[model samples]
Target chain A: MSSDAATDIMDGTHSALRTHGYAELTMQDIADEAGLSKAALHYHFDCKHDLLLAFLDRLLARFRERISDVGGDDAADRLLSLVETVLLPPTDGEPHEFRTALLEIEAQAPYDEAYRSRLERFDEVLTEEVRSILEDGVAEGTFCDDVDPAEAASFVVTYVRGARTENVAVGTALGDSLEAFRGYVERALLAPAATSVTDGGDADDGAGDEVDGE
Target chain B: MSSDAATDIMDGTHSALRTHGYAELTMQDIADEAGLSKAALHYHFDCKHDLLLAFLDRLLARFRERISDVGGDDAADRLLSLVETVLLPPTDGEPHEFRTALLEIEAQAPYDEAYRSRLERFDEVLTEEVRSILEDGVAEGTFCDDVDPAEAASFVVTYVRGARTENVAVGTALGDSLEAFRGYVERALLAPAATSVTDGGDADDGAGDEVDGE
Candidate 1:
């Protein structure tokens, strides 16, 4: 099968996931969504699991590309960009269908070890990115020296994941969550000089809302 | 039905959740797990959703009871106890089957409005408890005065929920997560004097490991 056909089939799987969820996802539905015959879908992916695994790989790669696209020499700005990219809604303000689908896939992790391992690998990449940024910030004297980069990275990843889950599950605003996380980073993670300089003028500024545009 | 029978039925549902997950939980499996007849199980809960609703209510009530059972005059200690109760494994150190089940139920929130509302109620209760404790700590001059209790409570609740999800999803150790959270709390939430005193003697102490027993 051509790579284009596989990509088209995966796009159909994404739509199927958004509409029907993982439990109700069917090969027929995916093929129909893709505008491809069932036989053509089967030619590319032998089973629904195979299609989903490929889709997940694509999703992870897309997230990595977004991270790398963040351009800045300042570690703090890069970290903020990473956070905004992960938590903020798209610039078009469309509903987060892709993230919603990924969460549905993650729900299968407990029953399927392959899903669990794949999700873990995704988290590992995110954690490594955050850790590297924190280390850079510390070396530049922008973040506190005493804090462990790995633990801080773990906390950031956990907080963002939790906030995203809460937003998706309960209709909590992702913007509100990003603001709360920014507060934590300002007070606990950043060095004293950096905090004073960045937040000195306005103790209760609404600067967090500007993160998405950056 | 007697309350005892109801409790027993919920226990059976819990076991069913652990063994088969929510999607595959059947009345027959619940009946078999409870050692009750199918008719008897029907007497307690009309369907799987009814049984799960009852089970979720029981789980929330048990958590509230654990929070109330923490004996301490100090607000910080009470807060720590609450955190420990929520995140730490049981003293017996068995696998976290109940929490695992709760996480599974939460995944259904997006698809089922009833589940979403119930999980929101659970989170509201937890956030309220944390907010009340923080207020008490502030009043007692043990916590920072500048921080908003509601926002801090939200962050803590979000972080804990996220950490629990990560641990359940990826087989990460609950102890390490609890320790990371403790570090956040000690550094970010407590008053400076309290931090110096509570965490002064041992900067790199393995104090988090002792929370399971305390």
Candidate 2:
């Protein structure tokens, strides 16, 4: 399939998932949302599973794109921005419902290698982003020298994954967990200079919300 | 139904889940495992969903009991014991498959209030345990006074929930995460006095493995 056409289909899959959810979503529903006939949809993808895998691929691509845009004056701000992105509640709909649709698909990963492989990309991408941010922070003298970037990155990603999962499964407010993560970054990751610095003021300025962005 | 009968049914549910996994499990399978007629199974629990809720309740009760038994010389050991319990892969069976079944149930928590409510109890129990442990560590001066028990407990629980979910979804090794958590506790949770002490040496004695029992 052409790149543009593939993007269109992935968008359609998102819409159909929003409407019908993971359990009830059908190939025909996806095709309807894509504005393609059933036969045309099948011409590119063999089944709903293949199409959903493609949708996951698209989602991962978009995730990488968004993560790449995460920026601030320093590493701490950038890290919080990434957290904000992950914990972001969808503005247009019930965030819980959307996460529920996602949880259903994730539940299948253990049994389905295709789903598992695709889902693994999300964590890998996030872990890499976090590791790079930590490296940047260390190089800039914003984070502790003793800290291991790779381990801390893994821990952060694990926590992020856990925080989002708990929020969906237990109804912990997204904002609450986001704040919890912010506290962790401040206490565990930041160097004394960064936290207690006279010059670098972004972290302590109380304008964290404004800078973190929507 | 009698208490004995209820326990029997729950045990049967475990066996059935083990044999058939979550998705293919039928009420009849449960009945056969329990050595009950299908009518008896339906009499106590109306459907698989209700039965699963009851099973989760039993599981929570067991979790609390096991947590009560989690003992060590100091707060840190008890804490690691707790981690060991949470990250404990089953001894005799396919641990990943068992986790996958549990993950499948957890996936339903968002849309299913019965499951969500039941599952929420697990996190609540674990978080409370963690908070109490932190409080003990603080009172004993084994941990930093700057730490907030509630927030730290919440963070710990969230990371834990995420770790288990990622393990099932992406096949991340449980043992690897348990070690990562140990590192976090060492660097972030322990007071410097505790870490630098020459007398009380369990944490640093290289016997951490033997002390943190299975």
Query: Which one is best on lDDT?
Result: 2
For candidate 1, write residues B117-181 as lDDT tens digits: 88998789889999999898878766778878999999988888887778777767767777777
**What would the per-residue lDDT of candidate 1 be over residues A86-177, giving only the tens digit for each residue?**
78745542255555566666666777788888899878988999999999888887678887899999989998888877876777788888
Q: lDDT tens string, model 2, B110-199?
A: 667888888888989999999999898877767788889999999999989888988888888888888788878877777765642222
Residue range A31-51, candidate 2, lDDT tens digits: 899888889889999999988
lDDT of 2 at B71: 72
Candidate 1 residue B200 C-alpha distance from true site, Å: 4.9
DockQ for the candidate 1 complex? 0.60
